[model samples]
Target: MLIDAHCHLDFPDFDADREAVIERARVAGVVRFVVPGTTRERWPTVLALGERDDVSVCLGLHPYFMETHRDADTEALARALDAHPDVVAVGECGIDARFAETLGAQWSLFDAQLRLAKERELPVVIHCVRANDQLAKRLRQLALPAGGLIHAFAGSPEQARKFLDLGFVVGLGGAATHERAKRLQRAVKSLPDDGYVLETDSPDMPLAGHRGERNEPARVAEVCRVVAALRGQAVERVAEASTTTATRLFGG
Candidate 1:
């Protein structure tokens, strides 16, 4: 079974046909999805989705929407986790270098989530954009107990190695499907068999040929195929290894 290790299925983008979207993915042999929360307001929707058999949830404050976050959101996240012990992890949280103004706030929010993940013994599903080095440094300072994933990893092999050494698996999504992402392709090829997981950050990172269209979970199969070709391994082997890695990190 293929698992989309990171996706935002609760977002309004799929309101019209979320069920149909899930069905298509199921038909394509994608059995499970890990949906991460972006902000406090979206937590309920994410939690509701987690109640379904096919979904797992990770709650956190996303850096991109820094203005929407409140000072109390961090405590609220802790309360939500305490109230719902079944939550799989603690994030889609990390710093975004692109948003210069929110960098400081992002660090505080990310640190709070990391502390909560440690306290609860859960893994994290991180969202990092152009902040890999800083993110890696923080992870080294405050190590995760259950480990986690670095979603949509597009870094050099050296950077990927740092995250792997810190016990975090690199998540490869539609970004790697592009021929222009040779560095990421090389990282995918050279990563340890157990160091990578497949994802399709749907409604966001479109594949090479599917630009401008809304991405979906079914495309994870294509992601696996791309990773397989990059690694010179069979698609089934890639599927099995990634599935094992995901199951070990977040469970089935």
Candidate 2:
């Protein structure tokens, strides 16, 4: 089964037809999805969706919305994990140095989640950005539980190798679909088959042809198609490998 390791189905953007969206994605051969929590406010919604057969959930404090997090939120997330068996991982967490001025709270919240994951023994799904250096350094300092994937990874080959060596997979998606993303494409090409996974970060990072449109979980197939072509393999092989990698990371 194809698994979108990262998506935001709980977001209000899909309120009108979220079920229909999942149905269409299933019909399009996208069998499963992982929705990561952005804040305490969204955890209930994500946990509810994870009760469904096709959904897996991760409780986290997303860096972009770190301003919304509070101390209680972290404690609440910890208490909520055992409520469901499909609560697979503990993130959608990490740093986003693209806007470093607003990053202090984000780092604290991210570190909190990492500490929780370590204590809980859950893998993480990080959201790293231009702050690879700092992110990598902090990760080494904290030494996360079992490592995690860097969602929508856009980095140099050296950075790519560093994360892989540390036991993380490189998530490839829309960013590598554009021709102008030369460095990202190179990273994707150089990454080993066992070290790469597929994701859409849907309703956010749309592919090349569908730019400006709502990216959905179904778009993961196109990403598979593109990345497979880049790696000189068939789509099915890419699908199988990515499916296995995601299952290994997030548990399906």
Candidate 3:
């Protein structure tokens, strides 16, 4: 079975047919999903989704939607973590250099979640975009006892190595399925067997042929196939390694 290491199954995109979606993914060999929280308001819905046997959840504020966050949301997150013993990690949180306007607030918010994760000894699921160096520095500053996953990772082998040294597993997803993503494909080819995991980031990062359409967990099977081909390994081997790594990092 494959683990979709970063998906938003709780998001409205799947609400109309969530169970059917999950079932379809199950039949397609995507047996589990790790859904990360995007806002304080969505935490309850995300928590509800986690009640499922096949789902794990991470709670955090995302950088892309900075305008939706309030100062009290961090406290709310801590409360949610305390109220939900099953919470697997502390984030979908990290820097996003693409949004220069929210950079400062993003730093503070990301730091708060990082600190909470450290205090709780939980792993994190980072959402970095064009901010790898800054993120690497912050990770060093607030070291986590349980390392994390860099979701939807698209970087050089050297950049990935930096995250690995800091005890993180990079997530490979639909982005790697494209013919033109040579750099990411090359990075996947060179990644240490245990230093990466598989994800779909469904309802978002659609694969090569599915652009402009809603991505789904079932598509992670295609992601697994592509990654295995990129790494010159059997699909089963990739599934086994990614599942083992996912269990190690997130423990679902």
Candidate 4:
């Protein structure tokens, strides 16, 4: 079975037919999901999804929503993690250079969550965009005990190696499936057996043919097929490797 290592199933986009979406994913051989909380207000919804045997949850403040996050959210995240032992990670948090205005606050929030992950010995699910080198530098300094995932990773092969060397695994999603994504495809081709995991980043990053439509966990099967082709390996091999890596990183 394949695991969708990162997906925002808690988002309102799935509110209409959440069960049907998960059922479709199961039918497609995608059996597990990791749903992350982007804000303090969403933690309960995210945790509720985690009650399912096949779903795991992560809580953190997303950089993209920096304007909504308050100073107390980090402390609240700590309490939430303490209250929910089943929580597998501490993020959906990281730096996004696109929001230049909030860069400084993003770092502070990201660092707080990283420290929480370290103290709790839990993996983190990061959302990095155009800040890989800077994020990698901070990761090096912290050397978190429980290495995390660089969710929806769109970095170079060398950058992928840097994260892997730091005990973190890269996440491959629909973005890597595009024909013109040569750089990302090259990164996929260069990954080691345990260096990456599969994700859909549903309701956001639609796959190549499904552009302009909502993405869902069911499409992870296609991601596996494309990644296999990129790495010149069998689809089942990609599925097994990605599932194994995800299970190890976030637990079953």
The local distance difference test score of each candidate is 0.93, 0.86, 0.91, 0.94
* Residue-level lDDT tens digits of model 3 in 1-252: 899999999899998999899999999998889999999889889988988898999999999889999999999999989988899999899888999988999999998999999999999999999988878888888778999999999988888988999999999998899899888888999898899999999899999999899999999889999999999999999999999999999995
| Model 4 CA deviation exceeding 4 Å by range | none
lDDT per residue for candidate 1 within 42-66, as digits (tens), equals 9999999999998999898888889
1-252 per-residue lDDT for model 2 (tens digits): 578878899999999999888888887789889899888888889988988888889988888886677778888877887665568888778898877777887888888889888887788889998888777777788777688888999998889888888888888989999999999888888988789889989789989989789999988988999999988998999999999998888865
* Poorest lDDT segment (10 consecutive residues) of candidate 3: 134-143
Question: What clash pairs does model 4 have?
Answer: none
**RMSD for each of the candidates:** 0.7, 1.4, 0.8, 0.7
* C-alpha lDDT (0 to 100) for residue 76 of candidate 1: 94
Q: Between 1 and 3, whose lDDT is larger? A: 1
Worst 10 residues of 4 by lDDT: 99-108
- Worst window of 10 by summed lDDT in candidate 2: 77-86
lDDT score of residue 192 within candidate 1: 90
- The backbone clash count of each candidate, in order, is 0, 1, 0, 0
Alpha carbon deviation, residue 229, candidate 3 (Å) = 0.5
**Ranked candidates (lDDT, high to low):** 4, 1, 3, 2
